[model samples]
Target: MKTMKTLLSASLALTALSGCQPETEKPNILFLLVDDMQSDAIAALGNKNVYTPNIDGLIAEGVTFTRTYTNGALCGALSMPSRAMLMTGRGVFEVQSDGMKIPECMVTLPEQLRANGYQTFATGKWHSDHASFNRSFAAGENIFFGGMHPYEKNGHCSPRLYHYDRTGQYKETSFIGEEFSSKMFADAAIEFLSTAAKAQNPFMAFVSFTSPHDPRNQLPDYGKKYKAKDIILPTNFLPQHPFDNGELAIRDEQILPPPRTGEQLQEELALYYGMVSEVDEQIGRVLNALNATGEREHTVIVFASDNGLAMGQNGLLGKQSLYEHSVGVPMLIIDPRSKKHGFKTDALCYLYDLYPTLCDIVGIEIPASVTGVSLKPLLEGTTDKLRDDIFLAYSNQQRALVKDDYKYIIYNVEGKITEQLFNLKKDPKEMANLADAMPQKAAAYKEMLIQRLKEQQDFCNIDTPLWWKDGHKITWDELINLYIFE
Candidate 1:
C-alpha cells in the first residue's frame, strides 16, 4: 500500500509537470462576475421567488455549480486578494504587499491567455493592488471603482483606472452607476466583444458588476418591482444576533434595530431583492448581446460572486462571520463545447480553482505556482469528484475546513479561538452545533484545520503576522488610500 501511494504521488507530479490539454478548440471566454450576490438570490439556484430569468436562462444552457465557495466573506477582506489569486492562480499569500505592487514574478491568467493568442479585456471593480492589474490584462477599464466612491452617488462619472504593463497598454473609460453597474459593465464588454469578433480573435472579457452591495439602493424601476409589504422575511431572521460571536461592533449594528414585525423585515428584504433582480436583468442584456453577435455557441460563460451576503440570516445583514450564508457563494460555468450541461456537482471547489480550470478548459498550460487543481475532468463528466477536502481562511479572523458531510469552523477573535462543527448532510441550515457533543470528532477536525492552514502557508507563502492592529480604526478614505498604496 505504501509503495502504491508513493507511485501515485510520483505519477501526479509528472502529470502536473507535463500539463494537460482539452480535445476541443479553444473557446472565447466571457466572465460575468457580480459583487455581494448571495447564493440563494438566483432563481436557477433554487430561489423560487427571485426574478432572475436571464441568469436562469444561462443555467439552462450550462452547468450550475451547487457547492462553489469564495476565499473570503466580505468585500473589504477578500476582493483584492481573491482577484489576485484568480488572476495569478496563486493564493493571496503568494503575492507580496510592497507598496501597491503585485509580485512581478507571477504570471496572471490574462497574461498567459494573451501569450496563447488571446486578447483580454476587463471592466469594473479592479480592487487588487495596481501592480497586479497593470501587468495582468491586455486592456483595462473601471479598475478604480472599488475605492473611488461609497454607496451614495451611483458610481457614474468615476475616473477610469488603468495600468501600463508589459503585456499591453490599459486605457480608462467612463463608467456610471445610474443605470445599474451591471448594465454599464455589460455595455463595455459587448463593445469589446464586438471588436474582437470582427478581428476573429479568441478573447477573454471580464465583466464585473458592483451591485447588490450596501447603501441598499436600487434603481427606481427595480425597487418598484416588489412592494415592501410583499417581500418575504428569511426563516432565520433574528431580532439580534446572539452575543457578538466575535464580529465587529459596527457590522453587528447593521442588523440591529431588528425589524419589530414581519412587515419591517419584508421591507428590507424587498430592497435587497430589488438590487439582485436589477443585476439579473443586466445579465439578460449581456446574454442577448452575445447571441446577437452569433458568438454564444463559441463562448464559455462563467457566473459567480466575489462573496456571499447574510440577508437576515442569523440576524446579520453583512458578511463578517464564518457562517455558510456569509462565506458560501454561487458559481456557474457554461461551456458550449462540453456535454455536461444541466449537470450539478456536489464536490467541494473554491473560486481560486477557476484560474487553472479556465486554462484547462481552453487547452492552455497553468503555471507551477498555482495552488488550485483543474476542474476540467469534473466539468467534462469524466470524473465524479474534484477534491476530497476544501479549506477557507479569511482576514486572520475565521478559518474553516470542509469534507464530505462535515464542516468545522474556527473563529479567531481578539487573540482567542472558538470552534464549531456541523454535520452538513443532516443540517444544511447549520442550526445545530455538534461541537460539545462530540469531543473526539471536534479534536480530529481541529487537527485537520491546522494541517490545512499549514499547507496554505507552505504552498502560498502566507504569513501569520497580523497586518491590521486590533482596535485600530480608520476612515473610508484612509483605508482606500492605504490599500491603493499598500
Candidate 2:
C-alpha cells in the first residue's frame, strides 16, 4: 500500500474526478423559549397593544406559524407538559409527565443532537426534571428548574438554580437573584454563545425565559411606560366566566377573582405587556451577542413559547382552558442562509412538531420515537400545509375540535355535559353559540369531535349520550336546566 499522505491525496483526486464535493458546514441552532406568550401578544404579529421589538425582529426575519398550539390537555402544571411535548415530540395523551418530570421517551431533541456530534448548551428555565435536563444538555448554566420565578410583593425573590452537572446529580443549587430572571438567562446565553464560537463542532443553544408569565414584577420601570387606562379589553372579556368548566379554583384564576374590576384587568394587561417587552429587550441582548460571534452566519433561530395564556379572554384568566386564547402559541423559524423571510403559514400544528422540524433543519435523522410531523416542507417552500383540522382538550372536562374556522366544544363538568359550536370566521369572538339554532351542523361537529377525541385517546367516556342523533344531549336534567336558562 502507498504512504498515508499519498493514499489521502489519491482518494481526494478520485473523489473530485467522481464529481463529488466536500460537505458544507452544518448550521448552528438557537432555540428561544418564552413562557405564557399568546399567539397575538407580539406587536409584529398584529397585536397593536404590545411592545416586543426584539421578538418582532425575529418575526420580520423568519417564517411564522400562525396557528401553532400546545398539546391542548395536560395534567399537573401546564408548562411542564408543554415543554415535555416539545422536547419529546409527542402529544399530551402520548407522553406521561408526573411531578414535572419528563416521561419515558426514547429520545429528546437535544439528546438526539448531542448524540449526532452536536454540542448543546441550555440556560434559564427548564421545568422538566433534573435528570432529563442533565441528559438533554452537554453543559448549562443559570439553569432554573422551577415552575415560576419566586416572587415577592416588591419584586422577584431569591430563586434557586443549578450549573451543569456531568454526573446528572445536580445536587448543588444557587439562589441567584442579584439580576432579574430574563437578564440572567440572556447573560448565560451570551456566555454560552461566546464559548460556542470557539468550539469547532456545531452547537445548539436553548435559552428559555420565565418572564411574562406570572409575577410580572421584574422590571418596574418597563411597567411604568404603559398606562392602565390605555389597555384595551378583549371583546370576549367578562366579569365572570360564563360557567365553571372546571379549574376555576386554580391559582391562575385566583390571580384576580370574579367581578374583575375594569381597573384591575387594565392594570394586569399593562403590567403583562411591560413584562413581555422586558423579556424582549433581554432577548435582543442575546441576539446582539449572537451577531457579534462568527457562528451567526450559519445559525438558525427558533422562537416559540411553551403555551398561551388568557389574561382576560374568554371570561377566563388562566391557561387551563381550551379556548383559542389559552391554547394558541407564537412560533417562528429563522434561517439566516435562506432567502425566505417574513413569511407566515396558517397550517395548524402543535408545539411537539419542533423535534422533527429541527432535525430536518439540521440534516439529522429524526428518530422513530418522535411522533410529530416535520414542517420542513412548509419551511422550505415545498408545501404550505401540514394539517387540516386541530384537536384540543382540558383534562377530561373539555374537548374541542376545529376545522375550517368552525369550532366545536364539549364540556363534561362532573358529568353534567354541555356543548358549544361557533362559526369562527363570522364570530371570531365566539359571541354566539349555534348549538341549538343549527342542530344539524352541531350534530355533525359533535360527531366529528367525538371521533377526534377517540383518535386523540381522550379519557372522557362518550357512551352516555341518550338521544343526540342530529340533535342535543338529552341529559337527566337538561330540560330543567334549559327551562331555568329560559
Candidate 3:
C-alpha cells in the first residue's frame, strides 16, 4: 500500500486556476533528536517549571532557533562532539576523532539522506561510531549505543540494544530493551512510523532520544507529580565552581558534591524536570506516530538537543561549561512550507548547522566535506543573521566568545590563567565578572576568541603556557575508553 503520487484532479484544478506553486513533494524528515535537552527546557521556552506539553507543542509550531549552539567540550564528553557535530555537518575541530570516529571523509546527515532517495532511519542514542552507524541508516531499529544507561525504576531497565547492521560490523549487539529510555525510544519511533507510512521513498526519521540526560530516574510513575519541595532554584544556582573551571573533576562534574544546595539544587530539579516530563510523554507518542502515519503533513520536523545540561547551573553539573546552562540547545524547524508562524530565530546558529540545513531542505547536493552554514536563509524568512561571532571550545581548558552584547570567557587550568567577561545582554546569569571591568572589552573578546579558535579548527592553545600542554591528552584510561560502547 505504498502511495503518494497525486496532482491529477485536472492537475489540481489547473494548479489552482493558474496561481502556480504546487511543486513541493520531497519533505519527509522527522529528526526530533534529544538528550540533555536544555535551552530553557521549554514551557514555550520560558521554563515554567517544565511540563513540556510535547516540547510546548514544538514551541508553538516550530521555527524556534533561539540561538542554538554546541561546538565545545570534547573527550570530557560533550556526547562525542555533540553527536559528531550532529552527524558530520562538521565542526568542533572538524568532527573526525572527537566525534569518536567518523572520518571516511564525512558526508553523514544520515549518509546524505541515505544517498538521496531518503528512507534513512536510525533509532536512539548512537553517539557516533559503529562505522558511522554503519554509514548512516537505510533501515534501523531499537538501537542505542552509549552516553548513558542504567535507568531502572519501574520500567525495569535492560538497555543494551541495536538491530540494523548490514555489516557496518555492529556484530551481535545484545538487544535487550525492556521499556524505559523514553519507552524504548518511543517504541523504536512507533515502529518506524508504522513502516514509514507504507513507504514509497521519502523518509529520514533519525529519531534519537537518550532522555533528559543522566539517568534521572522516574521510569514509570512518570515523576510522581513533580515534587522536590516544588523545585525552583536556578537564579544561577551555585555552591561551587567559582573558578577552576578546568572541568573541576569531570564525569559530568561529579554529579553532585560541591557545596551546592538550595535543597540540593531542588532535588536535581526534581529529577531534571521529571526526566523532562517523561521525555515529553514520549514526545507525545512520537507525534502520535506521525499523526497515525499520515506523515504529519509530509514531515520535515527537526526539534533538537545534543548538549545543554547543567542542572545545577553555574556550579556546573556538566556539559563541561560554556554556560548558558551548558551551551544553549533546543532548536526546531518544522517546515510545512514555512511562513514562520511560531518563529523565533535569534540566529547565532550551529548544531553543525543541521547538516547544511538538511541539505537545504531536500534539494540535496551540499557536501564538500561539509562545514555547516545553511539554515536555509533562516528557513526561508530569507535572512536573520547567521553569525557575527560565536565560538566556544572546551578542551585545552576553555575559551569562549559571543560578540555582540558580550560574553568572553577564557581559562587555562594548568598554567592557572583565568578571565571572564559576560554582559550577555546585561549579564544573563553570568553573575558579574566584567574581566577587570571590561579590559578593552576583554581584549576584544580575546581577539575574537583567537579568531574563533582558528575558525573552529580548534585544538585550543590560547597562547598556552600549559593549556593542557598542546591539547588532546586524555587518560582516566582514555576517558574511560572514550565512553564505553561494546
Task: Report clash pairs, candidate 2.
Answer: none
**Residues 382-472 of candidate 1: C-alpha lDDT, one tens digit per residue:** 6567788877765556677888899887764554556788998888767777999987998888788778767665221122333135522
Candidates by lDDT, descending order: 2, 3, 1
Return the TM-score for candidate 2, rounded to 2 decimals: 0.88
Among these predicted structures, which one has the highest lDDT? Answer: 2
Q: Give lDDT tens digits, candidate 2, residues 302-418.
A: 999998888888778889887777888999999887788899988889988999999998888998878899998888886655887787866556778888888888886665677
Give all TM-scores, in the order shown: 0.82, 0.88, 0.35
User: Which residue pairs show backbone clashes in model 3?
Assistant: none
**Model 3: residue 273 alpha-carbon error in angstroms:** 3.2
Runs of candidate 3 with Cα error greater than 4 angstroms are 1-32, 35-84, 89-91, 95-111, 119-196, 207-224, 229-238, 246-259, 262-264, 287-305, 313-318, 322-396, 399-459, 466-486
Candidate-wise lDDT, in order: 0.65, 0.76, 0.74
lDDT of 3 by residue, 180-296 (tens): 767777776777677656655677778788888876755456533577887778788788878777677876677787877789888888888878788788888888989987878
The deviation in Å at residue 149 for candidate 2 is: 2.0
Candidate 1 residues lying further than 4 Å off, grouped into runs, are 1-25, 73-76, 97-101, 141-144, 147-149, 154-178, 220-224, 251-262, 415-417, 458-486
Runs with alpha carbons beyond 4 Å of true place in candidate 2: 1-24, 152-157, 218-224, 465-486
> Pick by TM-score: which candidate is best?
2
| Backbone clashes in model 1 | 3
